[model samples]
Target: MVDKFPAEQQRIVKGLQDAVDRLNTIARGVAPIKVNKASEYFDLPEASPAAPGSGVRLYSGGGKFTVKTSANKTVTIPMADVANPANFTSPSTQTGDFASASAYTQLRADCARLHDTVRDLQNAMRAAGLMG
Candidate 1:
């Protein structure tokens, strides 16, 4: 009782809707990634005058690279500057922690759904001879 072309068109529309839904679901599941700053170098309390060596000690803290000199002088080099001083130790590139397992699971599920939608979309396009 319905036109064959309209029926087929409806099927294609439904497939596209499904694909969009999957994409939306995947987007919701995605997580943002953050990178951590490199550890900094600190100067331990000046050893007694007669004490052993004292120069600079490496210390990790908020993402910043800093160094302390023997005279209790401290200097911090912005990450951007690390590269300016060619031949200098490159700043650390360690990244921050990751999302929770549950979040990851949800993301994975969404990705799977998106994958399925892509497949369906491809099939619809093929049936329409939109592809060679």
Candidate 2:
């Protein structure tokens, strides 16, 4: 093929082939990049609000995770409060005993309330993408 081409073209082809060979050799000697797990777990600086009309920003500090929206709205969650069942309590203010005539009726009412609370929690978890 080099003989069929003009001298200048043949020289250019040779140079290109040499460049490709050199690249292949360099690629073989290069190690594949690896992820550094330690670097991935670095602590973030103090939380700051995101600019309005820009985008949301996530921040972590003081043992809490904060998300600030472009509208300057922010929500923070404590890291220690995550996935702790004891931290999830019903906001219901049903302080008094069940208003039932019989003990059996009161027990049933209490059980129903408990079931509803659990269901609400599960729904919340699902909405947050923490539960399947």
Candidate 3:
């Protein structure tokens, strides 16, 4: 039998999505993106204008927080995260022509792979006899 850990986990997730499919449109997210997770704040590369702990979640590239298992979630950022300074530029964390081009590409590819893996996992889990 194929591995049940990851597969079953994904099936459960897919089942959740399938169930949500019957919900009203209003319960869904906007057209572009539909998510209610707190970590969604980092969806953008931009920094938040609001001060720290403003009782709001933002896309600022600072601070570290736990996510899921917190495996690759232990993150640390420099103060240069958001520079409202007159001379604002993509910080070192940014992967532009200035930064390591190859590293940027590799990271991009890795993210894509991870997304697909999780997606497949979720799909597999929903396939009867895989998880449930």
Candidate 4:
């Protein structure tokens, strides 16, 4: 003959699941923090010259007590041929925000909770001799 769990035991299990679900529901609107996006590959003047088929050209650009011997022209410029670097600049901003460790932390927490709950259920079932 099969033994059944008491009603109180079933109620306890159900209540635990309900509470976990409620916690998840309440955390739905957590917006990630906005990260300040810095540009990589900033334009550096060739300081000498640009050869054909080369992206680096020797050009001069500096002024106002900064570059005393600044060259008058920019060389090997990347933007010289390409139109609109802005398109490549924006999406990287998610507004292209990378996933921060904090986000991973939240995800890790969720996964840990999920794992623990699943383990709890598995152990409970095993104890009750209901697991295969």
lDDT per prediction?
0.54, 0.63, 0.48, 0.48
Q: What does candidate 4's lDDT look like per residue over 19-130, in tens digits? A: 9999888888676654455455444452433343533333344411112123332322121222221222112233234586655565566666667667766665555444
By TM-score, rank the candidates, best first: 2, 4, 1, 3
Report lDDT (Cα) of residue 78, candidate 1. 39
TM-score against truth, every candidate: 0.26, 0.33, 0.23, 0.27
Over the stretch 1-132, how does candidate 3's per-residue lDDT look in tens digits? 876687689889888888778564546655655565565344444443433332434343544321221232222222222222232232436534645766666666666666766666655545522344
Clashes of each: 0, 0, 4, 11
Off by over 4 Å in 1: 1-97
RMSD of each: 35.7, 12.5, 25.1, 36.4
Worst lDDT window (10 residues) for model 2? 79-88
What's the true lDDT of residue 51 in model 2? 54
lDDT of 1: 0.54
Local accuracy of candidate 2 as per-residue lDDT tens digits, 1-132: 455567689789889999999999999999987655455576666856555577767776455676677877665643322332232233243445545345545556667766776777777666544567
The 10 consecutive residues of candidate 4 with the worst lDDT sum are 77-86
Taking all chains together, the TM-score of candidate 2 against the true structure is: 0.33
RMSD of 1: 35.7
Q: Per-residue error at 8 for model 4, in Å?
A: 61
Question: Which candidate number has the best lDDT?
Answer: 2
Q: What residue pairs clash in candidate 1, if any at all?
A: none
